[model samples]
Target: MKQDNITAKREQEKRIVSLMIRTYCKGRHGTRQGLCPECQALQEYALLRADRCPFMEAKTFCSNCRVHCYKPAMRENIRAVMRYSGPRMMFSHPVLVIQHGIESIREKKRLEKENHEA
Candidate 1:
């Protein structure tokens, strides 16, 4: 049961990150169809990280995660993608943005409580 939950969370993270990368690639790279080669590589790397995330059960999103699992260069690349894609997500994926915001807040509160307890 715990494994199932972790798998679901991982898949959801992958889906959201993939969407963000696709949006960034299309808007920035002017790719009319699927992701360009560069974005595709980034997407794959992001998904692999998500798959291996140790804090998947606790973290709501990569932005809220304290541990940086991504290598420096890939982390910078993902940051660029998020910066370009985040505001745009309001127009393209408002629901996801809202949900992510809510989840981040909840996760922050949960972590605070854990720290306070400890």
Candidate 2:
């Protein structure tokens, strides 16, 4: 595959991972609980995107700076796509679920491969 295709595919998978994190955080998942006032505000700001995240303050801190806390280039892509497509994904595409599932499985395999190689 060409370099651009790899980058684009990585970008899409990054979006999928980010979506999973947000959804997991929103619902019951891990054993841990509680969010700091800053993280809480950040979460809401993340959801409504009303303002910048206090915990991750800056309009583009993670992705722009390539923070280790987030997968490289993912934060921006997720923010951009969700900002535009969240509602559309809900009502427009009937294939959204299947597409997401397949992408997720691929991402998991990719991660496993990378980990094994490392």
For each candidate in the order shown, give its overall lDDT on alpha carbons. 0.89, 0.45
Name the weakest run of 10 consecutive residues (lDDT summed) in model 2.
50-59
Give the poorly placed runs of model 2, Cα more than 4 Å off.
29-94, 100-118
Clashes of 2: 0
Best by TM-score: 1
Residue lDDT tens for model 2, 8-88: 554544454345334444442332455434334434434443222232322222333323443335445445545554444
List TM-scores for all candidates, in order: 0.88, 0.32
Give me the candidate number with maximum lDDT. Answer: 1
Task: Give me the overall lDDT of model 2.
Answer: 0.45
lDDT by residue for model 1 (1-116), tens: 39899899899889989999998999899999999999999999999898888898877777777898999999999999999999999998899999988987888899899899
Query: What's the C-alpha lDDT at position 105 in model 2?
Result: 75
What's model 1's lDDT at 111? 85
